[model samples]
Target: MIAIVSAPTNLGLRPPQPGAVPGTAKAPEALREAGLHARLLGEGATDAGAILPGRYVDHPNRSRNAVRNHEAIVDHARRLAARLVTLTREGRAPLVLGGDCSLLIAAGLASRVARPSGLVHVDGHTDFRHPSNSPEIGALAGEDLAAAVGLHLPEIADIDGLGPYFDRAATAHIGCRRDDEHLDELADTIGLVLPADRVVMHGAARAAADVLELPALDRGFWLQIDVDVMDPQYMPAVDSPDVGGLSPDELIRLLGLLAPRAWGASVTVFDPDLDPTGRHARTIAEIVATGLRDLGRDLAL
Candidate 1:
């Protein structure tokens, strides 16, 4: 069965202004308001409620090596990881609704405790900023993938001494646009990579087929979907919306093809503040309802 767990955290992101909290912390509730929970419940999904986060404090003057809300994010990640371990132990596939991509830390942590796991990262940007590549790193959201692969600081990357939750050979990254500055670095790091243009050219089914062939699928994988993968024309509500991205139908079809095999999945980086009309919420809800309807159903083991 699919279990919907809300990790309503925006601590991974930098505040929009000097003193404002990111609106992404409200994403889980906003998606619920748009009928995602109702629709999924009717489809046999269970509600796992939410894991709350600490208050977002703007710290512009903090050292570059220090992540914003560092202690709070670590505490939240540990708690979130414990819950995920419990849910997976009960044989439920988790659908984590996120406030930002930093939730991947918890997911990676939990997956390590449950079993050997792989990662399938689908995002518009490579999200590879790390201490090795950039000195401007602090926000965990943008640097999540780097941390997940054990390329960041020891504290964030090696929580509980379980660093590098997903192996590079067992990781698949898809949907980054051509112009992403980190593309070259990512191409050298991740095992399987298919950029947006590649996906669009070959079609979703073919893309799915390629990913399914990865060695990672032999052990099952965690799927991370950042809604910003959709073109800004379709989904501009994320913290960073890039042009030349996928269409909504393409992303939905890709998810429908991929979710069944994933042990768990997360949907992140959709900021509600930019979407004043709530139309984006309804659209994302439908994507979750249709695309992930079969989540946790086809784990390798």
Candidate 2:
């Protein structure tokens, strides 16, 4: 059985400009409207309900919103982790739908509770910024990987006093743009990274195979996809859209190869507000359904 959980928190995004509407917070519902739940067989579904974020605020010394919303993010992470722990303990795979990439903190924390876990991070950007090196630190979503590995951001890194959610050697990052900020540094920490160019050159199936061969395969892993990992031409509904990315078909192929090995998975950073035509939402639903079907089949075995 697969449990679909909704985590709608946008405190991680750079605070919306004066009149800008927040679209990611609406992603879970938009995906449902596009038939994700029904296609996945709603019988096993569990709505973990949304965790709304507090208003974004700035600080003089720390990252804007990062310091102000620190407590709130931690609270939400704890609650979300608890729900994931329950589902995993019962042998149900979790399909977490997100409001932004920050949910990784929660998911990574939850994975550690079950056992030592690895992460397969599929995204357009590295999302591994450290406050000491970051010129501006307003968004937690951008620093998720750093926190996950206990690299920086103490408040987020030290969730429940359990830091370094995933062992550095056990994690693998795929589909990130080659020119991402600090790409070299993040590679050093993540250990296994298949950049966009590599995925395109080697093909998604081969890239997925290499990721699976990385350390910690036996310890279980979380498969995370930020929709922006798909090319902007195919998925233009993200806050930060890099030029080069995987095609939808390529992403689907990679997901099919990785799903059977993942204990849980998450789809994040898809902003429905940008996709006025709803095309992106429907595409996301198809990708998730296809991946979860494979995951369910693997679990059945």
Candidate 3:
């Protein structure tokens, strides 16, 4: 069984950010329509924050604000952590649907309660910049990957027991682009860096295969697919769209390939509101639905 958690909070971000559409987290609904029994963290009807925080840049990018979002980040993380642990203990996969990229923290920490896990990052931006060098030092979403991997502000890094939740050497970030110069440094620190070229030339299938070919490949896998990995023309509602990205066909193929190996796969398509035509939403829904279906065959948690 798969338990779905919807985090409809964009509060973990700095300004000039794009997040999952407000009142339009149709991903889980689509998943249910496709015959999956999914549940939102707080409520299934609409966006709510108990376990989820609303969108805002309450935390400073670094030292630029009053108080960092320490309390809020920890509070949210703590709640999600408990829920995720419960799911893991029950031997179920949590298909986390998010309001922003910051939700990665929950997924990372929760995976720790069970067997150690590896990550498959599929996105345009590396999502691994520090507050200091970030284009906008006022956002949590941007700093999320760093925080998960034992970086970022003290609160996030010192998350009580979850500090080492992120094993940098176990994570594989694929589909990184040149625009994300900030991420290049962080990616190098992790394990192997799979550039956009590899994702483009080889497709996510070949690239993911190559990633699994590495030493950490056999570990329990957690997949992160940022929708910006799709072209803007086809996926206009992304927080940041790289000029060169993988096609829908490529994405579907990659998901099909990865589904067989996912212990828990959580995807975030930030800035879904920026999608003007809802063309991107439909596209996202279709592809994700197909991917989950494939996973149903053997998707363990």
Best by TM-score: 1
Model 3, which residues run further than 4 Å from truth? Answer: 16-50, 54-62, 65-68, 131-136, 294-301
Cα lDDT computed for each candidate against the true fold: 0.90, 0.81, 0.64
> Model 2, which residues run further than 4 Å from truth?
19-21, 42-49, 52-68, 296-301
Model 3 lDDT, full chain set: 0.64
Q: Tens digit of lDDT per residue, candidate 1, span 1-301?
A: 9999999999999888766888898899899999999999998889997899998886757898788888888899999899888889888988999989999999989988996788999999898999988977889999899899999988999998999888888888999999988999998998888899998898999998999898756888999999998999999898888888899899999999999889999999889898898999999999999999988677743
Say which prediction, candidate 1 or candidate 2, comes out ahead on lDDT: 1
For model 1 the TM-score comes to 0.98
Q: Which structure among the candidates has the greatest lDDT?
A: 1
- TM-scores for every predicted model: 0.98, 0.93, 0.82
Candidate number with the higher lDDT (1 or 3): 1
Better of 1 and 3 by TM-score: 1
